[model samples]
Target: MPEIMSDTPTDFKHFIRIIGRGQRAGRTLTMQEAEQAMSMVINGQATAEQKGAFLMLLRVREETAEELAGFSQAFRTCSLASVADLSVDLDMGCYAGKRRHLPWFLLAVMLLAKNGKRIFLHGTHEPDSKRLYLKEVLPQIGFKVAQHPEQVQVALDTFGFAYMDLKQINPQLDDIIQLREQFGLRSCANTLARMLNPSHAAHCLQGIFHRKIDEKHRETAALLNDANVLCFRGEGGEVEFNPLRDVTLHVSRNGQQSSEDVTATCETFITKPQELDAKQLISVWTGEFDDIYANHAVVGTLSLMLVLVDKLDWTEAYQQAEQMWQGRDKKWPVVLPEDKSEVVPFDTTGKHYAH
Candidate 1:
């Protein structure tokens, strides 16, 4: 048995014991225990072996809402709590890298930001080159990726929206997210990062590729007691919905659970963007190019959040989103990097794990 003497530094051993017993022998941790365990990991008190064992053990079993909330709480406790007191209206989680689409959701967020909605977007770019991640596309489209919380504040102040890298919010958890390449499996880090809501924004929007994870996000939001949360199976596992398909969203507003469906409004089906060029995002935003699939995708995703925040009703939300998209600023300062040589090249092995 692992020693458990009082005042000893063996809390991780205890956590491992609880989570890593033979599949049938182990049980899930209580909410408090889960929070403590995650805290230990984030604070760097746990060894790498212990972190791997604990995360992999939890991955084998789906995490409970209680466990997710506890883990998020631990991360929130350690995240940079102060961010220059910027007024943020939404916490957008964008973890799933785009594979089949051009991240039309970026255009949607930009539209909202232009309309004076302070959107705080945070995500990790998986090290895969075959897929287009937001961080890689942001620069190409003349948007800045924030490396720190203060920069996030500045971006929000300047453009009413900002994209933040999860690594900046918490490197320890980002390190765990990177472990996907080594373990060949995604652990709870991906899920937990979505719930970070580091800025404690009242409303959170999450997109996942799987339906089961959609429900998990909804339930976890309730556990966190967030005022508003909207989640659904989004395009390519992002928060962007496919305009060609009816999307059923799980929502938590004011601690109440509800479901809403954004019916397909497009006449044609589009499995992928017509073009994958990063410049196309800017062109779409500037009205240089018009695409039915991408247009409705932006409107559909914006409407979901508009309704979730009680800013508008379903019908009104769609109408308003369309109007917002139609009137978006075509010339929102595009500052390209002077030197493109510093760009990180992505690995093109293309073995994407199920997000």
Candidate 2:
């Protein structure tokens, strides 16, 4: 890193020094210190150079659960909290876009919303992302972006779901996130963004691109005392699963953390995934397309969520999800409404819970 200019603000300068002391002398920040460091960035007390240096240093050394917890806590301290009072059932953090396939998990969310689950989905779709973003597909499926923070409540009340970009929720973090452009790599911002529960929703779901970070996420949820959470290595870093690949899900329930190693289903369940297309999600939902992989992705994601929310076993959850899929509002979401809906945790061990 360039020498800290003599004019560097003391507010965040020490933090950079602490973490950038080279591998041997540098150590992880305590949750409190991490929180303090993040607070400076969020509150504009940190300079751009300091922000990049701090984040990239953590990225190189990797982030701990405590740091993730601290970062999220700090960010939320200044976040736009218009919907904090809502009784949201699920908090969905979907920042990673998909490159391998359509985000079928979205259809699962739509199904839950249709069935009266108040869900809040928050993330971003950068202009430079190479992968497909759900924001693009949301319009085709009758979802609206809450333009302002207040519109979030209306969308949830009227449609049972809502979405807001990070800029709308907390521009500071979004701005920090964009620093990836300058740094040429992602920082802890992406992970902590997923860790935010925003509304203290009853349940939360997190997906990470790296398997190693899965435990950090689960531990962070435990640290925050997240009521319930599911964390796993998701498809292309999304909250959707790769049915053909075994996934170990780290779940935290009522403050207790556990891991469930889910076995991969038959290779035939979802095979030969079609070329990426957002319309495929809508088509599959409308019964106009038959892609086994997409179908399994939807049902499996929905079933897993059912297990979390209703506490049902896997078999029953799958049955329930299949039924929900077969019984979804086939012709609903017929047209986009004129009014704007606003647009748009935890770690555990390797243990198996009997389904």
Candidate 3:
């Protein structure tokens, strides 16, 4: 007797069908459904077609807060392996590289690190991306790049800062992110990646390019019950506060039902960069150069993160940030090529291992 094969489609296909049911009938996924669907996507249970379809369908409509929250939870649960406990004071995401200007924000982060704030910073740069990503420039500034989770843990413990590329954090997610080459547009993967907050830090900072995604990001953190989250429209989509103009970023403290709005500290709207040079980031940090705009950008960015990281009010954070800037070592550290010590300044991903 021949046995009959069932015609049931894969569970992931239901997500595709529901999401792509045409504008008139399509509805967003519930938080639970979103979590389950993203888990399937991350775990390789979803067919390639289902994965693409679900992402594109959701891309057509901005993701709801619940969808963002659900997707973030799934990735955290399904990360490549248990990430090391870096005991990071902050989780900083830097997916977007800088183009119009140098990434002065690195100075802010380094300053905070020098003052004893351990930061676990993670990012991804597409194969074809031309922007000045952290991986390309950090070494020039005498920083060491840790390729593994254990390196990050040790870096944080030793130097108070660590950087990892997303590919090392979870190559699976990086593969999904690199899909932009095929899709010609961003999928939810791009948005969800920033909120992973792998260390489960008490304070997490996410910067978005689109204003539309600001509230959604803050809402997602709130939904995740993240203790402290700052989601803002950043300069060049990196986590730097634009010091030239007034702006607003959302903050959620202890998973507040609604996030509060935080505004920029500077109102000056224009400054001139005589020329663009990645080396300027180093020069500025070492007190060898001064760009009014760059200095404000660094201090402003630091103050913004300080509000959450140190629990200081915005005004106090800004003033303290200035003092930090003034008190920083006037010269960049020299990491002898022979010295591979954890105390040496580090660069980005090379290997990732759990502690």
Candidate 4:
């Protein structure tokens, strides 16, 4: 009979050797190995030092699609709740909170919701900055943040959309992400989080800061067996498509490869944070504010989502998106009535801001 091999590693050190064997001597982990290793980290079986070393070593070489798929599967196993029965149309990730630009994509999502799409948005605002995280901006714009899975369902049932933070979805991974301050660099957690798709929506969109990571996102989604995923380099790394620059979108549908470049349609000179107004999100949505850049950004973003959902062809989608933006109701529930009875804790800069 032929010999059969088992997946048992001698120890954590043996697993570490697969990836940390030194610069030229190192090798990437097999998909199964990556999954087992990450599960150990998530399940609290790995030492703190081992976890740090594992993440840092992956960072040094950058992660591969198989590696990302394994990590993401492990994460999903640990954190994902059953929204599988819900009528979710999109899974949006906003992990890279806006820094260089206000979240124009937020308006795009609202536009989609208004058009009757059930969307779920999730993210974590790293304590490093107060620069317009979605957790803060959502409330300001009249959207509630769900701190629990049941609450996520409630928000979705009540509103067309809901936002969940990483800490709420998976505290262990959130703790790993916060390790940024300690490691002085991002680990694969950020990448995996973007691809998590907690609701297991049929379609997903990812925004990345670096142009180089575009392919990484597409390939990882493919490895995860996601039928439809669109990843592009957004303005400031949030999933909102940038209107100011030409962008090449990497797309994966049913493990097939396809890509296209979106030529810049608007040439605006506003790039700095001081030049942009956060309130414009509401202004534009309400049809009171008019800026060419904002208009194109919102429409362009909506057009992509529309295409992802197979609602329209790219060109037709753009035109229809413009129509939807022009005809958007000014009264789709911005802020709910407040009650002082219930107190909620807001996390800002690692300090508690309760109301």
lDDT of 2 by residue, 223-304 (tens): 8888899888888788887788888888888668888778765488443343555556667877888878887888888877
Best by TM-score: 1
**lDDT per residue (tens digit) for residues 296-315 in model 1:** 88998888878766547679
Q: Write the residue-wise lDDT of candidate 4 on 20-98 in tens digits.
A: 8877888888777788788777766677888888889888888888888888878887565655556798998888876
Give candidate 1 misplaced runs (Cα > 4 Å): 1-9, 22-24, 128-130, 271-275, 335-351
Better of 1 and 2 by lDDT: 1
Q: Report the Cα lDDT for residue 163, model 1.
A: 87
TM-score, structure 4 vs. true: 0.88
Indicate the residue-level lDDT of 207 in model 3: 84
What local distance difference test score does each model get?
0.77, 0.77, 0.76, 0.76
Number of clashes recorded per candidate: 0, 12, 14, 1
Candidate 3 stretches greater than 4 Å from native: 1-9, 80-82, 257-276, 336-355
Local distance difference test, candidate 3? 0.76
TM-score of each: 0.89, 0.88, 0.87, 0.88
lDDT at residue 19 of model 4 (Cα atoms): 87
- Candidate 1: worst 10 consecutive residues by lDDT? 1-10
Report the CA-based lDDT of candidate 1 relative to the real structure: 0.77
To one decimal, what is the Cα RMSD in angstroms of model 3 from the true structure?
Answer: 6.9
